[model samples]
Target: EEAGEHVLEVEVSLPELAELLGEELRLPAIRPRGREAVLSDVRRYRSIRRTGPESLRHFRRTFRTALRRQIAEGTYEPDRPVVVPRREDRRYRSWRIAEVPQSNAAVIYMMDVSGSMGTEQKEIVRIEAFWIDTWLRSQYRNIEVRYIVHDAAAREVDRHSFFHLRESGGTKISSAYELCSRIVEERYSPMEWNVYPFHFSDGDNWSGGDTRTCMELLREKLLPRVNVFCYGQVKSAYGSGQFKVDLDDELGDDGRVLTSEIPDREGILPSIRTFLGTGR
Candidate 1:
């Protein structure tokens, strides 16, 4: 009662944050597609043996064995029913250790660094990316993340540069898609890896030709290989906001392709659900 230090320390783990995101957004657990390349050792107790530790003793089998022994020896009586298991009658469980397939994932994050995408838009992308990574990490045993940013052209960068690097130029959304396709082809094989590509942009493209190129890349190269292709259109004051509309009109019928319009930071959760709720 004398000590007045009443401070409580709170630490939120990545798994806990992932659980919160799933609960709030009603997200479905992702079902990995394609061959699971990773293997994990799993032990299953399926057979009974004669000797083992007491922890693994099979009581029913031991009693049955004792009763059979007594009956054979003519020591078991109907009036006075009792069963005592001898040391030789003890039964135990035996386990079979096997290698089972485990699913692994690769997440490729793409963002537009054009002049139109402002600080607020990047911040929204950063926050959304963090939550999405948290949820995906919880789902898969091994996960790899790659970052690509584009203005007039696209280039791969580290996590720090992906979010903070500033670029002032015209936007070409197709460049990022091309880079993503290359990365997927070289590193992540469709038969072995569950690939997820998430792209954030202001929905401002330099030309309709580039938009067409993006759609072509997605349909021919990206969509066929990935588990899901998610496009998040972060709102910007100078953005034309036409790319999402085009994606809706073109790829809406494909379940592997998803697009969400993030008007502001408040829309992050719903967008996440839209991207992941299908369990693909």
Candidate 2:
């Protein structure tokens, strides 16, 4: 019984768990034929399987032993059944410990949780952020993630509340930017940390003047101190969708400012790739 339990444990660790996920849902790096690609090729597909090829190597050896035993025992009648497995029949993949470059990255996630931003939008942000965290963690030895949820005012919150809190205050984009700048100044020094500020919103603002203040903060305070500032405008029936256009018109040529649109949950993956693909 003990030996049976050990075998069960070993089987549980196989890559078959990941393989069982449909091709579309599986992480890009572990997909069939994906092993040939370098980490740089799919940095945005951030899910990392904890069990590498080394884990599977043990199973391959065990399978070979089992096959040989079955053949010797005459459980496999080669002549009558026409069963054959040559020395070349055995295939075991080798895994090399990839030397992933160590870079410090700080991602500041700011979300608008005003009346216009609904639970569906928040869920989308939550899912995308999880994948982003996974990918960045794989690449960097040290990663710091800061969450700021904003309405007319903004405050730093823990990871749990960042994705779950529901509030109905008015929208003011600058408050979030200001809070994000303070977090950077206090915790993440730009000299040592590759800062990435990503803000998710429905493009609703309290006023045109507040939008101008947001631009000012990005240009004067945020952009200069970070590697990249990303803004994802989530589409909403109540939103005007003006903030993204404003930022694009103002900072279209600025490499530091990257922007994307998340129309729904389906767009989350591509948006994550767009934001992090630069390795900035």
Candidate 3:
């Protein structure tokens, strides 16, 4: 039983794992439309043997012949003698090298960490971000991700801090946008990077003037450089819920601006698909 189990484990391959993931995720067979094709076929490359026949099938035959020769020579002492294989007894497996294009994407995830963004809203953002990252990774080999969390002010942080940090300061959405624009200008150039900036909030801002400033930043600085700028308004009881409407009224004609309402965790997946499905 142990030997059988060991054999079964050794026989399991990468293709089998890929098939399992495919079935579990129910990922659509859709590939990125224009440049690089999705990975449809998954398999393992076989290694070449250094000794005997070049092919495994041929090597097996040669191995059998060598054993038979030893038996005929009458030098096959079961206890002390051994059989030596010649150079023709080796075999090997073959595979092709697959070259894939590098996708230049920079995802800036900005979120409001004010008192209004409660545990439930944060959970939704976490779930949605995971799916977005997974889908983007599948599509691009070179995906750069940046996380910014804000309350009264905006600051760049690592992934852990972005999702976990909490504050009780007032909301100023424009501050976050300004920080994002600066990051793009200093670190990520529009010509070299395909930018995707996503902001999540409870749709509340400090003032209308700040919101107007946010719009100006998006219009003159962010919108032209990015492939898509997505805004997700997470519903909160404490929130006034006015930012999304303002964005729609101002930037509805811009193809690059995408806005969605994430009422709860259940809406996270669809919202993510809405933001990324365009392959922009």
TM-score of each candidate structure, all chains considered together: 0.75, 0.70, 0.68
Q: List the residue pairs that clash in candidate 3.
A: 52-87, 52-88, 52-89, 52-90, 53-88, 53-89, 53-90
Stretches of candidate 2 off by over 4 Å are: 1-93
Which is the better candidate, 2 or 3, if ranked by lDDT?
3
**Cα-based lDDT for every prediction:** 0.87, 0.73, 0.76
Ranked by TM-score, the better of candidates 1 and 2 is 1
Q: Write the per-residue lDDT of candidate 1 for residues 1-280, one digit (tens) a residue.
A: 3434433244545755786788888887777766785567877565679989998887767887898999999998766577778999899878887454478799999999988888899999999999989999877778999999999999999999999988999999899999999999999998889999999998899899989999999999999899999999999999988999999999999999889999999999889999989988
**Angstrom error at residue 264, model 1:** 0.9
Q: Pick the winner on lDDT between candidates 1 and 2.
A: 1
lDDT of 3 by residue, 1-280 (tens): 2222211112424333333333455554323322433343433343344443343333444455666777877866666445666655444444545433354678899999999999889989988887677666655557899999999999999999988999999999999999999998888776667678999999999999999999999999999778789999999999888999999999988888998899887787668666765546
The TM-score that candidate 1 achieves is: 0.75
Ranking by lDDT: 1, 3, 2
State each candidate's clash count: 0, 0, 7
Model 2 collision count? 0
Question: Best-fitting candidate, measured by lDDT?
Answer: 1
> After TM-score superposition, what is the CA distance of residue 139 in candidate 2 from its true location, in Å?
1.4
Which 10 residues in a row give candidate 2 its minimum summed lDDT? Answer: 30-39
Which sequence of candidate numbers ranks them by TM-score, best first?
1, 2, 3
> Pairs clashing in candidate 2?
none
